[model samples]
Target chain A: MITAAVPERENYLNNAYGIKSWLLTRDHKRIGLLYLFTVTLFFFLGGAFATMIRIELLTPQGNFVSSETYNKLFTMHGVAMIFFFLIPAIPATLGNFFLPMMIGARDLAFPRINLLSWYLLVIGGLFSLFAMLAGGVDTGWTFYTPYSTTYSNSWVIATALGIFISGFSSILTGLNFIVTVHRMRAPGMTWMRMPLFVWSHYATALIQVLGTPVVAVTIILLFCERVFHIGIFDPTLGGDPVLFQHMFWFYSHPAVYIMILPAMGIVSELVSVFSRKPVFGYQFVAYASMAIAVLGFLVWGHHLFVSTQSVYAALVFSFLSYFVAIPSAIKVFNWTATLYKGSISFATPMLYAFGFIGLFTIGGLTGLFVAALGFDVHVTDTYFVVAHFHYIMVGGTIMAYLGGLHYWWPKITGRMYPEGWAKLSALIIFLGFNLTFFPQFILGYLGMPRRYHVYPDEFQVLHVLSTAGASVLAVGYLMPMIYFIWSLRYGKVASANPWGATGLEWQTPSPPPVHNFDVTPIVTHDAYDYSTVIGQEVEVG
Target chain B: MSEHIDSVKTYALVFAALIAATVGTTAVAFVDLGPFSVVVALLIAVCKMLLVALFFMHVRHSTRLTRLVVLGGLLWLLILIALTMGDILTRNWVGVPGR
Candidate 1:
């Protein structure tokens, strides 16, 4: 490890002491840290709800809780994970921390709005908590109609309003990233020369700005239904419930891309860094990110195959869904190619990267199965669908998140976590994750539906296995929480380029100063340009 | 920044036209145009949205990449709505045997 180049240690502990300063801080790094703390808190809350759900499913009866309570449990879990955690987890924390630094800027273009987004998250989060305390809505994350507006006993309006507010937070964040990427890059940091992480985020932000408003309107219409009895989604009043699904998934489906695109970007970086090579097929990988984001919008109807949609429509969506996979396959293959004939290291980030590839491929392929109308009819709400999404959202997104956290810990904290433990946790997470999710796929195919409090006796074996693996998964997740915090105080001082990485963030001091760079260094070479850095184009002031 | 940019006045006029079109569609909703009403409303909404997106969002003046990004969202939205309707419209003619 290289020694940190900070002129003098700025006591990170005393740097911003009061809650007010932290709340009011304009520093992008501080904002990122704030999100890190909040999102982590919500992660466990969501995880606890998930644990409750898995435990309830351990038996074939509604013994652990009533059906209503179980419904609330899963609904809250889905909302908390999607809205509060996954969507913002990586981009908000790591993206906020590093995007400005990587592009050689001091801060995001709109710092006050950056701070505002976090506050919006907290406020929206509180609204959700209040809604839960007031007897939570039992409508699933999709909030399918008739069930949501006409049937559910809980406060649908409050929860829908909370989500509507949070959608603005996402939109604002996307707008800021777009402006920053457009106007804030240092001289010579060309479009291709920027890190793949930024490129992926750029694509994600494009979707967020364009797609999020549609959902906001949809949710507001739902809220109006609850309050004013607006019959847009009310079938008896000549409104169509399927239209709501259309609008919701129109945003929520691409929202999945918003969730995974950044993770793909992270994997691209980690694979190249660990393998010590320029990413193979850089242009294809780059354009494929945009392709996925664009194609992601067209295929939302695939989710509606079993509903009132026509067979011809389902066939079209199935074809589009399969086509979307082509770009995803291209990305996966390029990553594999980048690893070919290269110096591959089993670093912690690289370990997580490999886990992402394996898990995401499984998740994506199964998505194909569900997207096909015939297969979806057999297992629409079954454990298979659950397993399919969990592989992508949890196994794929969360793994890349941990990988990015480890990759950038040195830069953020100026300290390195213990390598052995990091790798151990990565391995445990990989194993525990598969154990928890894989059985659900089989159980689903065996005709076990999800969201039911209990299942048949034969499925109990798998359910118990899933619960046991969840215990292990919890352990794997908690390990990093313990060690990463410990490392901040006592770990070795990290050098400017501990991983010998080539991003501009690495060229600066570890625990970068208030202003990221003392002088902006013009990036005259391609990203991951170890060869150019060593052989030809030098960093210029 | 440039004096030749008196076209700002023209762009403003275009913006007013969008507002008028939007209000016009909403107002004509009361006039019982039958199925044609929905089509007319949506067509006008599309025009206004496009004008704002292209001119006000600066897609027209922006680089090819930005135009591509803007076009991508629109084109796919059309595909989704169109293909969905394609299936719904054809369903009556095909008439599945079970029903």
Candidate 2:
């Protein structure tokens, strides 16, 4: 009988001795671990706020919390989740760790800047946590003006400050990834030879570098007008409030692409690997990621259909929004085509990939509905918009994030997560997620508005259904937290290349070395070259 | 990885051109070019922008990839400002009823 034989001693986890080593280390892998730890805490904090919001929505009346408190709950939830969690979720952690490794580099182009980006995120998170603890902001995560500036007396500046500082983290990370990809590839690992994960991340970094600062400038204008009377977004001082929407969504719209593009990249890797075939139309999948990033910048005006922007501009934006769906559709088609006539595996990662394709398709189709000027005018502020984004953000990105996490778990932790438990959790999360958000699409179509805790008697049943699903979703999320921790102590030790994957990352030992590859790799084939995995590259397992 | 150094003469020429463009912008602002006054000033500004980006910012010595990405960012910025300004300026274009 064959058994796993790779030694796990003296890895990056064991090379460092104390807390100071991790905090001060420039090793990309350790920094990835640090991002994983901090990002998970923010995830649960966001999740807890979401829990409270769902619980309150269970009944027709605002019985769980007061109206003001509900406002704070959703605002903090969106702020915690969007800026802190979703924007940096896949890229900062998984992409930070794996991107350098896959490209056959020891670290990002500037290792110090990589560490600085993590610290920036933490400090930014602190400002947000301070805002949450100090009475919470109520102007919505969008932070619309006059209300954010004048009327609603919540911690708008503090939350905006947190968001402001976090934008630098994004900008720096984008700059780092762009430079690293351009300069740091191993010999023969040309641009096309790099994995789709790196390709997607490259696109994500571009958005971060170019788009994030727009929102940063918007935020600076936000509080400047509030505190210094800059007359930018405030209407009482002759500012157009819709200008706030323009600058905010300029980044925020592409920001959604920032969240999902890397997830799509992960799904690309997962589909190719688990299907045991080279990705069908690999070049198209790679270019599709870039196309989505580019087209994503043009469609921010879809958010403004009912904001009373010019109808002509809205018409152009509405037309452009349909174009983004093309590149995203290319990705889904290729993933499906890759699976066709291939030796497929039912791994937990593949399960989430499947979940992502179906739900994202639903989300993308519904987006076309609202992209219409006529339809969006009716359902602009309703639960339909909320459901559409949740499908993409939650159903799409989070599913792909968890899938990537599980796919790379053995490489990151040197232990195999229990397959049975992981599969169950993925199933639970998928089912619970649909149960929760699917009804909201119907609720919004029936004209149920979002962000309001109280509603009429008729909407209670669907609310109860959603709340019930949220409970199950909570259980689904909690299982992975519990079992993943349990796996660290008692799980089977993972072998290098346990999945027989073909990326350069899998060429190294499980958990990898402090500098990733012991010697720099010289790539010889494409990213999905599974034939290379069968002999010399395959270690004992 | 070799650093590309520009000669002082090159730098001096670029600086003189920038100063000349600044004077041209000011001179254009004073002219009664009718509706084209804004257009003329903007044209001079664009020339200044190209000069600074190519010479002062080192894009002239940078890699082709760097030049492409820099162009992409500038084009995207133009999209944001121009499209947004277009949206705001055309509110009256759709023919409202009252006036």
Best by TM-score: 2
How many angstroms is residue A111 displaced in model 1 relative to the true structure, after the best TM-score fit? 2.1
Report the lDDT tens digits of candidate 2 across residue range A407-519. Answer: 89999999988999999999999999999999999999999998898999999999999999999999999998998999999988888887889999999998898889899
TM-score per candidate, in order? 0.92, 0.93
What docking grade does candidate 2 earn? medium
How do the residues A1-541 of candidate 1 rate in per-residue lDDT, one tens digit apiece?
8987776655333466788888889898999999999999989999999999988888888898899899999999999999989998988899899888888888998999998988888888888878988998789888998778777888777778778888888888888898999999999998988888998998888888888888888888887776778898889866878888888888999999999999998999999888889999998999999999888988888888787877777787788898889999999999999999987888899999999999999999999899888889999999999999999998999999999999999888898889989999999999999999999999999998888876789999998889888888999999999999999888888877777778888887788877878799898888887774454321110
> What interface RMSD does every candidate have?
2.2, 1.0
lDDT tens digits, residue span B1-99, model 1: 222332778798997998899789879998998889989988898898888887777766777777887776677667657765776685566666789
Against the true structure, whose DockQ is highest? 2
DockQ of 1: 0.49
Q: Give the best candidate by lDDT.
A: 2
The parts of candidate 2 lying over 4 Å away from their true place are: A1-8, A535-541, B6-56, B97-99
For candidate 2, the TM-score is 0.93
